[model samples]
Target: MLSKIHNGVPFKYLIASFQHQPRPTFPRTSPLPLRSRPIRTFSVQSILRLPDSKAQTGSRHKFTYDAAASFSAKHKDFNAATHVFHFNPYNRIQTQKRPKSKRPASGQDAFFISRVGESNAVAFGIADGVGGWEDSGVDPADFSHSFCDYMASAAYEHKPDAGDPTLTARSLMQRGFDDVCRDGSIHAGGSTASIAIASEDGMLEVANLGDSGFVHLRLNAVHSYSEPQTHAFNTPYQLSIVPASMLARAAVFGGAQLCDYPRDADVTQHTLKHGDILIFASDGVWDNLFNQDVLRLASRRMVSLGAWKTSDGGILVADDLKPFTQSLAEDSAQRSSTLQSVIATDIAAAAKTASKDRRSDGPFAKEVQKYYPEEDWHGGKVDDICVIVVIVSEEGKQQAIKSKL
Candidate 1:
């Protein structure tokens, strides 16, 4: 499903299920929204209070940020000026009926980050939540926060900085992951990691712990930057955390197991250009659409990237980003609400789609229906349709230069 379309035509990589029904008068919701939406924002204190590995075992640190001094140094003025827009239209399959369980963060998915000491550049990331029959006070979003912050701390504490910033970025992710996994406090489930780092010197690096991946959309081409694999094995030792069945499902698509964390995709010295977009996408969006499809939609408009500027003396807060992205789902309704900013979403929220379940009878086997299922992506385990797109302008422009006629 991750194929980019050129002029509304499907490419080889894009496998159109051929399961779409006639356009209905009402809106339809599915794994793909062909649109994006806004997400909730976490305060700086929330980010700071996250647990570092040492604290995971037992450190009494409540996991909160100190409000006195500022740790973020004007992230709005940043040179990258990357505008990110994303929506998880098919997030239901990932959510659960939430209840108290064996582990915290059972069914909560969050996008967390931790920056280096003085560098505005990020150092780590965490996502995915698991909750259901398996395991409550702890949300997966919480793990994402602590895990990312700690990763940055661990990397800075390295014996000595590696000469190459890119290598250092990679080392930071690898070692930090090891630290999180070693802790006895955290439990394992559906949670996954797709982390990355960019140093002040212009080096980029990323690593993922599951099928989720990153996309780099240049002016014309879209590049994938994550490897899909898991820790599943017939050997008893592998059963320590991740189950063999889960691992087998991951490997069904030919998974990889490298260095310490299953597998990863990296770049030694990837140089970025102006108008370039680097997206850290969850499976909800990536699994349903190809990377090129993203580029196609993004290239059509000049997204407001006020959030990525860190040099203009403005700090790109999550609030600054929410509106720009939320606009992707314009709603013509609710025009009087002062709180409403952008209206880019469709009017209807639900629709009756088609399914091929009736045509197939695989003897109760694989059940390959060879068709699409009817569903809505608005508020359940799959609640909340989302798509995050980050647009970066080399020229660093959110304003247009009007010419005198």
Candidate 2:
């Protein structure tokens, strides 16, 4: 169903209660409404190898889409890519001390590719399945991946107008939820969703379900960001709290199922300009690193790789992006950094903090063990982590300038 949000409405906290199911329980917190203060808002061949960095482990996949290449072949306007997209997705099952004989199923984080039906405009989303669903005898990763697939398809099907990104995000989530519900394999599972759509016009639309969120970086500072919906620490809002019929199942968790999920996502809009960077991540990253740390890590990479200099610390546009965008200048700063750099940096940060010894058998370690007792958490809280960084490509910006002429 299409849920409406009155612009400028004061933020309202809508807590959903879930019944226990013999698993971890989250506090009773309604889905954090997307606050309106938002005046804001792959290498093939190079394809098969993972990074050799100490920070990045687990399974990694990277892809780069250039509009000047295949995408532009279709639309003449795309002769120069209006934007370039790079993604580095990684996953690792929580490490176990004794380690399960058979890697206990799979890590529950899932990412969706946002391209379909002939336009360079695309969207990206990540879903992290709630650990509580393991009790249902179902692999929660299946649900998380399924939700992403459906959401991407829905975005393609509805094709919201370019100017109306808010609707584009909302429609994608609402319709994606409806599609998932139609399938019976996923009877009861929960996940957090953070998605963003960038159009040819340089407009970005974002939506968050639960604690998943995105942060905008410009001029070495976080210019704007999303507020996570959560009942307490570690428990963010989720798409599926519980089934309407089996609300009693959540009893063991202390919270009762309060509302249907996949409803209208807290949608926000932003006019993306050159030199802006957007970081979309799951709670695993935010919970572990401070906002400044996140930015510092990214900035450090940009500088070390020569993508940006300390004096002008803006995002770097890829050097050879002529394949991605048509009007890219030969002399502009070439991006030497890869999505792997950012993803690996985040995973390393989380691992370091989670593994940091308090010098005492602190309560933090106990909290980490309490949740993932079987896994060798390596002094770090063991949870699935995902990060996606989007930067305005130099070629795309040059194209924008040319178009204005």
Candidate 3:
């Protein structure tokens, strides 16, 4: 029997075998109607109480970020050195004449990192193509890759003065989705998205839909994270384009496709701080690793690289990160590595390892055990994994290391 495989599990199989299984619960709003709806307006301001900083003195402090990405397909081996992307704001973004072979080795999962216009801000995110689309003879990669491409272009060409509304995370997602709907090349597909925009003034905004999510880490702790939006077990809220034939079939068969709009994404705002780590990833990573696992992976990398140090009071960020964040050489290929790249690749590698482990139960396995105690599911759920890491640093702010107590 044909089934929708997401996170390496067949959705139909679980539903058929455990008809009375209690659904796993998460903190999320009820699924919205599958129709056009007004975008929910959200105030973009720092909601988290940030540590003592110059920004708290009513003066804006300029901040910079070192961003990189690492990804791998479930069927492929992960190479930490080669399968990494270092984000450079000055690099030119070419959306035309791009071949499919040039896309990241993320399989059906896609990601984009683009400088928002000429501003000092940056936008980056991930999109996970619904694996079930493959059962319908659709190439899920086409939708996800194209969706990210359109978003990158839109963000690159964005202008705050051109009578356009301010570019918020949700607006960027909506723009990308709108372009995908108009693109004649994409006939039918679906994907989940998690996007973030970090401004130079230390404010960060995020819009998340479905299982893909982002986490904010500071001082070796999980400061904040996103809640996945799902309708049922393994059925995530997804943005989709359905063909007329599929719609007609569904109407007669008395079943409907899960189609969600970008406006349905959950939005949150935060105040970024020096040495803070932000991780944006698809469900492939989240399903295999918990927040604490990610924190441990990143903390180990940061400390080993001297980007973070142990102090008497607590952990302290290094005063200078340029040595650790900047590229080693001018050549792109030969550039040795940076702190952010290592962190990104390390997390991806760990997730990949966990995904293939049969003895160690991951988050997805725990969820299955929670809802369907009868189903004998174990270990990790393997899928296409993508992770983007950002290390936030404030300019001219020196972190003082406390003396031994």
Best by lDDT: 3
Alpha-carbon deviation at 188 in model 1, angstroms: 3.8
Scored by TM-score, the top model is 3
Across 1-405, the per-residue lDDT of candidate 2 in tens digits comes to: 113212112212323343233124323224433322221122211111212222221222112232110111101121111122233222221221112232212257665555532344556776777766665566666667677767756555443355434437666767667666776766777777887776545577888877667778766677888877654434566777356656554454455652336554678888765555667766555544556666777566555544454545445544432232222222333333244333333433442344333332222233334443443233333345555666554333455556699
Candidate 1 residue lDDT tens string, 1-405? 323211112212111112211110122123432222111001110112112222131322111111110011111211111111122111111111122342222124334334343333434343443222022133333333345445645644433235434435446655545655665555542345566664433345665655444666553456435444432210000111343544565456544322233244333345454334555544333433344444444433323334233345432322223333323232343221111111101100110000112222211111111112222111111211112233322211222222222
**lDDT, each prediction:** 0.32, 0.49, 0.77
Q: Locate the minimum summed-lDDT window of 10 residues in model 1.
A: 346-355
For model 3, residues 1-405, the per-residue Cα lDDT tens digits are: 333223455444222111211112222234533221111000111111112322332435577777889999878999877788888776777765246888888899999988887776789999999877766678888888888988998888988778778899999999999989998888988899999999878899999998889889998888988888876656678899888877776666555667899989999999999899999999889988888888998899788778889999999888877777774443574367777777888889989999988889888877766655556668888889999999898866753333222
- Whole-model lDDT for model 1 versus the true structure? 0.32
Question: Which residue ranges in model 2 land beyond 4 Å of their true spot?
Answer: 1-106, 156-167, 241-245, 248-255, 258-260, 312-380, 394-405
What are the TM-scores, per candidate, against the unseen true structure? 0.43, 0.62, 0.84
Which pairs clash inside model 3? none
Stretches of candidate 3 exceeding 4 Å from the true structure = 1-58, 328-335, 399-405
Error of 2 at 77 (Å): 44
Q: After superposition, how far is residue 121 of candidate 3 from its true place, in Å?
A: 0.5
